[model samples]
Target chain A: MLRIGLFVVTVIGALVAAAPLIAIAGSNPLSAYRALLQGSLGSRRGLAETLIAATPLLTCGLAVAVSFQGGLFNIGVEGQLVIGGLIAGAIGAEVSLPAGIHVVVAILGAALGGALWALVPALLKAFRGVHEVITTIMLNYVAFSVSTYLVSPGGPLVSKTQPSATEKVKATAHLARIWQPTRLHLGVVVAIGLCAACWFFLYRTTAGYRLRMVGANPTAAQFNGINVRGVVVRTMCLSGALAGCAGAIEVLGLHGRYFDSFSPGYGFDSIAVALLGMMNPLGVAAAAAFFGMLRAGSVLLQAKAKVSKDMVTVISGLVVAFVAARVVLERRLESSASRRDRRRRDG
Target chain B: MADVFSINLVVSGIYLSMPLILAAFGGLLSERSGVINMALEGEMLFGAFSAVAFTWWLGSPWLGLLAALMTGALIGAIHAWLSVTLRANQIVAATAINLIASGLTAALIETVWGKPGVSPSVRKFGIVHIPLAGHLPFLGRIVERLTVLDWAGLLLAPIVWIVLFRTSFGLRLRSCGEGPEAAASVGVAVISVRYRAVILSGMLAAAGGAYLSLAQVGVFQRNITGGRGYLALAAMIFGKWRPVPVLGACLLFGLADAFQFRAQVAGVNLPHDLLLALPYLVALVALATFVGRASAPAAIGKHFIKD
Candidate 1:
């Protein structure tokens, strides 16, 4: 019952956080929400756009969620996405193969690229005890710089002299769309499937159980004979792999080619979505869809209202803070309960 | 021409290092207190934007710098509320600050200037060549070229060192950071001390941002600090949360940045892309070495709730 109360407050916080955006829009905040719901669900086109926007977010949110489950904050998803896309684009433009093979190569290449991006931090955290949060962030800047160079004129990675882009992927390599008009594609389905897979991996399997135990209490897990060190490295690796695949999926299923500086921090934004979702894979999917709707609606909101599109971001931030506050409060309540139990037993 | 290039590189290195050192020191305070203080970048943005906006109005960069400091303090207060008093997840609060700061600054710039970005021309923070320092050779030249902000920022290290290790307030701050329970037992007001430390840290970081806008650039860009806050935080971490070491880390990163720009200008055939990756690479390498087993204050990143 208390848990339910916590959940209600979480939603209320989200609503309150979203209030400023509506006020800025000069519409009834309820109407603004109605428009958002109507805009996204009013027609098939709206739904498609919501789903389209959610596609990358769902993948990225899961990527973030996986890391949180492993006691690591993999905030470098933005960097990994770019790295994966760069590799895929580098390969996608050059490789000549059957459409299936070409697509597979790009996807696999992107995943590898993302994993490689994660490797440095994983190694650093595992051996050097560097905090993943700090290194991954620094790595993000490096990733951006490298990606910028790759896409810039006279860059070794891409012909920088050209407009900031790489060669488009082959037509055959394009993702099959669920809707012809909107951006909805195979990646959405793939994202959901991956979420299910992650759900299974974290909940159903012994390895998953050990990973959760480690996340919840590393010492306790160690006492229970769990290979804590091994879990840290492998779980981080797994998290990175998921993050890499998110990047790969975005590039292949949507953008159709890798390019430097494509995502406007989808990786980072997913962190918010993951938190909102309570770090559960299924919850991530739901939160991603909601966030994606707001994202897709931002342009529309701007076009209709004079409010700067950036206000949407402010709302997102407030929501994240509120969610975090809730998490902290919940933990405190749980610990207090346990302490009470301890006192009762002692008495 | 070669000498000119080297001189310019040295100038640029210190120029870049100024704000970073200040912000990292600011981070050092909070990190020592156990808060991650990710909002440093946003606070810097607040400083940069407010400084540029007000300086343009008041016609004095000094006033602009003060405004930036106040803004940073306010931001620091907000962070303190969320992360310290409210006991929220530090990263969530920090990252939220980053996004909100970026978005708010962009939006505010639009509202204030009636332009999307790069605010209207303001009084540029001028170059201050110290008369005495101007006499020396290459080394003297670098010192002479330092701006007013540069001098103030350079002095921050020793001041922070004293405050963090020598002063009573500093001791209390560390007590809260290293172990809040012990700190509370010792009669230190753990939450209040942390609030002071983190807010002061924000004010300092804002000064860094002010250096960027009021002095470094005449205008503001949406992503102006461009992950420098994170870099500074890394420097703090690499410095292992120590004042002098944090300064060292900032200089190291500043050097990487300075060299990268020089290398780019020298126009070598080697991939400039690689140069771009060097700071991050250096960070990874540094973390692998010094970051290993680096002990943090026990209560760092964990909020102390009174039992």
Candidate 2:
């Protein structure tokens, strides 16, 4: 019940805060919100766009959620995803084989790329005692530079035709679109499947239990004979793998080629999504869907209301700030409620 | 000719390092008082945006600087409320602040300026040559070429060192960071000290942002700080959280920035992306290996919940 209240408060707060900005942009807040709802949910095309946006977010959110469960904060998802996409893009363009084999290789290559990118930070944290936060953040810039280098003029993977993107992946490797003329593709199914798989792995497996144990209490887990360091490293690797899949799916399903700066901060946005979902797979899916709707609707809002699409960013910021304050808010509410209960009993 | 070249390099390096030095000082205050300031990046962005906007409004870089400092302080207040008072996870709170700043600044730029990418140029801090220094030997020439903010940053470094080591406030702040419970037991208000330190940090960091817009660039763009805040944190770690050492670290980073610019000017013909990424790559290497050997404050990032 408290969780429900928190969610409601967050939504309302976001709306109220954004109202003035909407007004400043010469649009009524009510109509602007109505446009958002109608655009994202009122039509089939909008729904398809929302699902397409949600697919990568789901995978990225799962990546963050899994790492959180293992007592690691994998803020390097952005880096991992970039590297993963670069590898998949490079392979997708170069390889021309049977569809099944080609697609598998590209996806696997992406996962490996992500894991490799994450390995540096994990190793630093596990062996050298360096904080993952700074290392991961530094690696994000490295990933951007590397990706840009790869696709830039005079670089290894520069496209002869487009100049800023790589050659298209072979048709055989392309993930088929589920709906004609809409962006939704087989990647959505793959993302959903991965979500279920994460749920099973986290709750139904001994390894998952061990990971959770380490996350919950590292010293206690170490005392209980768990390889805490190993869990930390492996969890990051798995997390990177999940993020890599997000990049690969987006490429194979949507863009059809690798380009520099393809992701518009999906990796970063997923942090809030993971938090809102309580780091659970099911919750992550729901959160991802809601964000996807926002992403889909926000563009229409921008066009119709003449407001900058950047307003979505402000909304996101408000949500994260409110969510971060939840600990204090919830504690206060619980204490007041308990006091009220005592008074009623005494009376 | 070589003397001239070297002097130019050093001057440009100092210019690049001023913002970093200021931001690192801010981080030092917060961290020295037991508050982890991961939101330095966001605070710097807010500073940069407001500095330009205020300068455009008031036609005075001084007022712009004041506005930037206040904006940074406001961000720091939010961070303190979450991490100190509410006892939320410092890192999560900081990350949220960064996201919020990124979005809010961008939206604000778009709404107020009717543009999406960059803001209009504003009143900037004009250069003032030191009268006697300008006529001196090579060293004097170097000093004369430095911007007022650059010299201020240089002077502020020693001032920070003195304040941190010599003053009663510094001692209390360090005690809060190193042993919050002990400090609380001994009648020091740990929470209040942390709040002050964090707020001070925001103001200093905002000054850094103001330098970027008002002194160095004369305009604000989306992401104008461009990870300089993270670099400032790296500088703090590299300097072992000391004011003097942090100044040296910022200079090192500034030297790298200067070198990158020089290489570009000399037509080094490197891949644009590789050259653009060199500073960050250097930062990553420095952090992963160098900071692992440095010891941080004992009670850093730990919440002290009083009964």
Candidate 3:
């Protein structure tokens, strides 16, 4: 019940915060919101696009949620995702295998690539006690540099026809489309399945309990015979694998290859999505869906309402800010309720 | 290869280090006051945007600098209100600030300039030759063509050091960071001291941003701070949060950047991308090997509640 209240307050707060930005763009907030809704949910094509956009966000949001559950902030999801996409694209282009097997190998390669990218920070955080935030952020730049170098002109993995991308992924490796007259693919189903698996793993397993204990109180968990360091490493790798799958699905389903900059900060946005979802798998799906609507509808929002697509960014920012300050709101409500109770008792 | 160590390289290195130095000091002040300020990047970016936008509108570089400082203060106050007064999670609040800065700046560029990504060139600060420094030895060559902002960046280290170490206000601020509960018990206004530290930190960081748009580039570009704010954070950690050492760390990074630029021009047998990644690689290695949380302020990242 409290969660629902928080969600409602957050949405209202975000809209209130974004009203001024909409005004700055010379558009009425009401009409702009109407256009946004119309563009995202008013038609079949819009709904399909929203689902398509949500696929990676759902996967990436799970990745961030998993890390948060384990008391780690895996900000390197962006880097890991890029590495995963690059590996998946390369495998899809270079490997020769049967249809079903090719896709499996490519995705596994992507997962391994992402896990390896995260391994350094995981080990650093677990063993040396180095902060993952700084290491992960630093590695993000390294990942960008490495990815750019590989696809640069005359560099290996550069497509013959396109200087800034890898060769197209083989048709055998493509994530088959599931819907007609829409770009929806098998990846959305996979993302949903992953969400279910994540929910089960985080709630129904002994390992999940250990992970939670470590997060809640490391010293107590340590004294209780939990392998805290190992759990930390494993949690980070699991998070990275999920993040990698996000990238792999984008490559295999949407883009069919790794481009220079395919993601429009989806990994970063997933942080906000995870937080807004209160780190629950189902809640994350809802938040990702909402954000997906914003992204899918942004094109029409810009064209119809004369607002920049960056308006979505502003809204997301406001949502996160409000969510962070929810404690203050909750405290105020509690104080007012308690005052009313005291007054009734006196009467 | 000789050009790698030339007077030109040293001067460029100093010029490049100016922003990092100022921004690292900003991190120093905030962290010393016990508020984790991951919003340095956002504050710096907003400052950069304000510098260019105000300069373009008002037609004066000085006013642009003033505007950047004011906006920095505004951002600082907001951040303090969220993380300090509201007792929100500092990192989450900072992340929000970053996203807002990025989105607001991008949208405003479109609104104000009718274009996206880059803004029009505006009036910029000119070099200020020191009256006597130009006549000195090798140091003179590096300092002679420095801009006024550059000098301010260089001089801010000692000023910050003195303010943080030699003043009663600084002691109170450090005490809040170390033990806010204890400080409050002793009649110190822990909350207000943090607000002041964070606000001052914002102004310094904004000055660093002003240096970028006004002194270095003469224009505002999208994401122009380009993670330099993070680099400053890394530098602060690398310096163990001390002002003078943080200045040294910034210079080291600045020199590395300068070397990378020279190596690219000199046709060094390395990928340009790898060269671009060098400073970050260095920072990562430095953090892994030398730094730990032991040296950090005892009460950093904790929200203090008063009854």
Best by DockQ: 3
Compare the candidates by TM-score and give the number of the best one: 3
Show the colliding residue pairs in model 2.
none
lDDT for residue A296 in candidate 2, whole number 0-100: 85
Worst 10 residues of 1 chain A by lDDT: A21-30
By lDDT, the best candidate is: 3
TM-score for all models, in order of appearance: 0.93, 0.95, 0.97
* Deviating ranges (above 4 Å) for candidate 3: A331-347
Candidate 2 residue runs with Cα over 4 Å from true position: A1-5, A20-27, A332-347, B1-5, B291-294
| CA lDDT of each prediction against the hidden true structure | 0.80, 0.85, 0.89
State each candidate's chain A TM-score.
Answer: 0.88, 0.93, 0.94
Q: Per-prediction DockQ scores?
A: 0.60, 0.65, 0.70
Instruction: Quote the positional error of residue B153 for candidate 1 in Å.
Output: 0.4
For residue A124, what is the lDDT in candidate 1? 80
Pairs in clash, predicted candidate 3: none
Q: Candidate 1 — which residues are off by over 4 angstroms? A: A1-8, A21-35, A156-162, A328-347, B1-5, B271-273
Residue range A246-291, candidate 2, lDDT tens digits: 9999899899999888888889888877887778898889878877
**Candidate 1: tens digits of C-alpha lDDT, residues A1-347:** 56446545765787676676556434456655656666677778888888877877888888888888888788888888777777777777767888878777777778777877788888888777888887888888788877787777776556434456677777766667777877788888878888899999999999998988988999899999998878887877676667777776777778877666777667877988888888888788878887888777766666555456676676667667778778668878889999999999999
For every model shown, the clashing-pair count is 6, 0, 0
